[model samples]
Target chain A: MTTTLALLVDLAAIVLLIAGISMFRAPQRARLGNLVAALALTVAVVLVLRRHNVTGLPLVLTGVAAGTILGWIVAVRVTMIQIPAMIAFQHGAGGVAAFLIAFVELTRSAGALTPVTRFSGILGLAIGAATFSASMVASGKLAAKLRSAPVSLRFHNGWLWLCAAFIVGAGIALLLEPASGAPAYAAGIIIVAAAAGILFSIRVGGADMPVLISFLNATAGLAAAFCGVTLENRLLIAFGAVVAASGSVLTLVMCRAMNRDLLKVFAGFTPAAAPAGAAPEHHEPKSPGVPPEDPFLAAVDALKEAESVIIVPGYGMALAKAQFKVVELAGLLERQGKQVRFAIHPVAGRMPGHMHVLLAEADLDYEQIFDMADINGDFASTDAVLVVGACDVVNPAAMTVEGCPISGMPILLAHEAKRVIVCNLDSRPGYSGVENPLYESEKAVLLWGDASDSVSQLVTRVGGEA
Target chain B: MLDLAIMLAVLVCSFIIGYLLISRVPPLLHTPLMSMTNAVSAVTVIGALLLFAVETTGLEKALGVFALITATFNLVGGFTITDRMLRLFRSDEHHQ
Candidate 1:
């Protein structure tokens, strides 16, 4: 094929891919968009095969076959809450591919590459290696295989700087060293960069995981782009660039939603202020002026009487595996001819938009869910707010408390509703360690137990009432 | 030099277009969006394939296969899973 034709084909594939992503703005169009993007990739791959003089066809087929089988098995079986971990693991795999390709190209070239390509190869090596390691850590945490709290060392920022200095120094060394010395320096860069990746990710904890995962998504794409530059492949370069951009947008969106800057998240800025796992078991043990009433019965009575209701869910709901019951209860309420909508905080899940996907898996009507911004105003007018397995997101203290850990963090105005019912594991302060004042309010009823059981009860009670 | 310029242009232009296109995607589809883009990043498989275009040393061949397998795994897994996730949204359109 002619060079102009190849470039044109590359552009065509990229345009198709962009079209696929653009369709994601609508829920109904996204599935078709995904297929279009896959077709674009298939076309790109076929073009590469036709244009290049590829050898060892059987070997290549073996690798592709193995990968496809493994991927198919995992993809078919993995559940919704595991999506973050699974995506992180895949990013690690991409990282491995990127770094290995970069390393092989650098070592095999023997100085044949141009200066820019050579620099790109070194960059790909560093980023790919780091992304691999960091993604592993992130995947482990998301999967609950590793501790979710930020693990900070003494002088953690200083260690990060050292990691940076070493990566830069090694990059220069690879550029300057004799071609014979390339392997040793490349290995050094990989090792240090991997360490840097771990260090960079380990300081981000719990709720901050969405940002860490998104950032790793960007680095993984960046590594691929650099690998493309070294190989001088337009298709690869364009695809990688677009993925990198998408990841960057998600990362920033996650950062902004949480009211945090990217630096403080990755920098371990306030480890002492909120030791992640150190949340108090319960917020307010005393009911200052109490009615001797059962919270569950009160919740049932409240739900039965309310004409309009909103449900707020947090990560704890996912942990309790209560999504099905939660959705079931929503259906019951809807069938009762009540106005029911779900309010989802952007930071509610382990990753961005996770709660929506989790609830979607339970087959809830997509129209019933609303973003926090879109539904925060509705809380005041709603007759009842049901908070399931959540704490911080519904905490009225975020808006009212001065200089508190969660102060200024956007929360669902669940507190604004005429009545509030909390179904949680306990009266615990959430990950933020801030005492929620919602539990003490006169309108609030607390049902402390496993979320699935509590939600199922609500489903049963709501159904019986109907 | 011309080749380098073309490659750079592709990267920059694609990035800006991607940013413009993806920024409009609702948070409802963000997970699938990430999954699909991640699959796109697996395009490093091209670089992996190039390694086999020429005769390779034993070490090089091993690394080449490793890269190929992981890249393809990322690609297949990412796209298939994204398709599944996106279907959730599509199927919901029929519901009340």
Candidate 2:
């Protein structure tokens, strides 16, 4: 009962701390706070066990503290973008931890090991090890260290059968002799399984890792839940369930975002390679019709002529840290008797609603921002479309290219605007690694520069501060 | 049990909200956000590792060692990649 009480207090304190910290920092700093909160909560849980005089309490605390400090040291020193890979790494750790716990539980329960025990343990072990390998490859792919490509065997279905035979044989042997004490065989099985995971993950490149990562995360959670059931631990059961459900949902959403059926992706499906005679249905940019007018003067002209101007914020806006500047520009534009609204695209950044959060940080009014469907129609009627650091999403190719990776993806049809002013740093293509034909479109005028500087200039031009 | 249910519900809801919000965010923030979340997850592993290490039971001791290994991977692997990514921007002289 004392242990329980300690856990309860720890849980409460940790929760309060995490919530409090989130209110202060952006996502980057919030993560650090989260780690601290987790450690505190663990201490609380450990305190509960201490009251029971649990013999392993000290060892446990030491392990947890060392691991946490190591993780913290790495996290603080690392760059912001590697967070996803970091997340994957954590998931991998969780998977291994869960696997080990389950293995220990199985051995403890069945001193001589029943077939059922061995089977279940081996299954969990295989999945956990495989998940670890898959996630590691995913991290590498995200980090761009290893090439992401599916390895295909020429002329033989035999290797796959051989792999299957080895796995099944190992399972049978382990089940037959649950107390085999043969770490070599067990190690070999896990190694082979991990190799399979690595090969499979590397094979499917160009697809996002979120889905695979989510799936792996779910596997890890399930392993933990399985351990909880084995050990009759309620807390582990609860936490594991939460992780599993959340991971599954995330996987589903990622699949939907990419417009691929989850099953097809799992089956290693790719749209048939572009067929011969398929003249890529490309849009030729309208002749660099007339070079764009000076954006500085245009900003003044826009405020003078327009009663309402909408500012569409995209990923480029975030990359340039121009949210604050955009806000200032909006304020100036409003002062000059014009209204400003931000057009937000779904999938604007790498994650969802990324632009909205950045804008919110800049203290922009949420209601003033509009979705793509709601604001796309207004482009033709509006005075100008000030596109900052956006390319592929605003391109028309997404709708036209049938089998292209982002072909079926929904995008804002900014090319339909009357006067399109694009704020891009250069002529580089987007995530798809293809040139954007939108830049060459007739209605488009590329105002090349950094997002923040360009927006600041626009603001200064409007406020006559320049 | 009730507390567990509540926690589960909160996690699910937060994940959904985060997932939806992901689409609207800029790609540049994705790595940063991911790195941060990774750190959050690592804490749990750390806690597990600490709990496992001093366990009197053979089972608990084994579990602790397992947790330590996993947590180490997450900490080292994640931070190393993140640092490399951040280096890309740091080398740029004009990055704000």
Each candidate's lDDT (Cα)?
Answer: 0.87, 0.56
What DockQ values do the models have?
Answer: 0.78, 0.15
User: Tens-digit lDDT track for model 1 on A35-125?
Assistant: 9999988888998898899888898899989888888899999888899999999999999999999999888886678778889999999
Work out how many backbone clashes candidate 2 has.
Answer: 41
DockQ of 2: 0.15
Q: Interface RMSD computed for candidate 1 is what?
A: 1.2
Candidate 2 residues lying further than 4 Å off, grouped into runs, are: A1-58, A75-79, A103-120, A143-169, A204-207, A263-346, A352-382, A400-404, A424-429, A432-437, A448-466, B1-63, B69-96
TM-score of each: 0.96, 0.67
What TM-score describes the B chain of model 2? 0.60
True-contact fraction in model 1 equals 0.80
What's the lDDT of the predicted structure labeled candidate 1? Answer: 0.87
Model 2 per-residue lDDT tens digits across residues A1-466: 3255645664554454335224223333433443553454355355445544445545655665666577667666644444445566677776666556545544444554445445655766666677778878776765556664444444223554565577788777666655655354566667877776665566554344556766766666555544544443344443444445545655665666556666556545343344456444432222345554564564456445666676766667766878789888887777766767777665554333356556655766555677776777877677767778777677677787665656776677666666566777766665554456677766565667788987877776767642
**Model 1: CAPRI class:** medium
Clash totals for all candidate models: 1, 41
